[model samples]
Target: MQIPVINRSRHALPEYQTAHAAGLDVRANLAAPVTLGPLQRALIPTGLFLEIPVGYEMQVRPRSGLAYKHGIGLVNSPGTIDADYRGELQVLLVNLSDQAFVVQDGERIAQLVVARHEVVAWQPVEALSETGRGAGGYGSTGSA
Candidate 1:
């Protein structure tokens, strides 16, 4: 699906790295490098604004390479960007490692994936249907 986007940053628009890639790699649009000390978080902008079609939303996710190599991850694993939102796309990044990490301009910090969603209508029900393992909380099932 074709999306309408406005890129105000110096870098080009984000695109899929591979033919089968699901998410487009998003970069940081910073005037200067921002350093993230241990356990510190920052809201980095992308200088991008776009409109998503109704019934769909944009998901902001962390890159696996960054998480594995530098212990860099997103505060909100999969942040939702509503279809109605028309503001600059920003990422909430956190440094999980003990050392500091620098967020350079045009660095591939996060990814943006467009997803389809359903509008659910709440139905007032007296009770939910019983399952084979009813009310089974975490770790209730056997570890295989």
Candidate 2:
């Protein structure tokens, strides 16, 4: 699928990949770094903006290295970017570490994955069918 990327500023670098076969990584600008306290929040901006097509959504996920090395991760992990959103691409990041974290400009704070979604319409039903373990949840089945 063809995705439209908008570079608002001339200095903004186009979306690039860290590894040839790895997913594409988005970077921040050169002005300032988005800061997050021990438990505070920050909106990290991606210089390169995108226009996602309908019936598709972009998932803003944490970079594995950043999350594993540092306790910083997305506030709403796997945040969704709708197709109709036309504003700047910002990542809602929360620092769960004990120390304050600084999201440096041009740092790979998050990763975007485009996926297709279906809008399922609900229909009124009179009654529901039963299953083997009806209404059983949370370890109702065997763990092993």
Best by lDDT: 1
Q: Model 2 over residues 14-98: C-alpha lDDT tens digits?
A: 4446455234566656377667779898886666677899999988888788888888888887898899998888878888888
- Runs in model 2 lying further than 4 Å from the true structure: 9-22, 142-144
In the range 5-105, model 1's lDDT, one tens digit per residue, is 99999998998999999999999999999999999999999999989999999999999999999999999989999999999999999999999999999
* Alpha-carbon RMSD, each predicted model: 1.2, 2.6
Q: The CA-based lDDT of model 2 is what?
A: 0.76
Candidate 1 lDDT for residue 88? 93
lDDT of each: 0.95, 0.76
Per-model TM-score versus the true fold: 0.96, 0.83
- Clash count for candidate 2 is 0
Q: What TM-score does prediction 1 earn?
A: 0.96
Which pairs clash (backbone N, Cα, C closer than 3 Å) in model 2? none
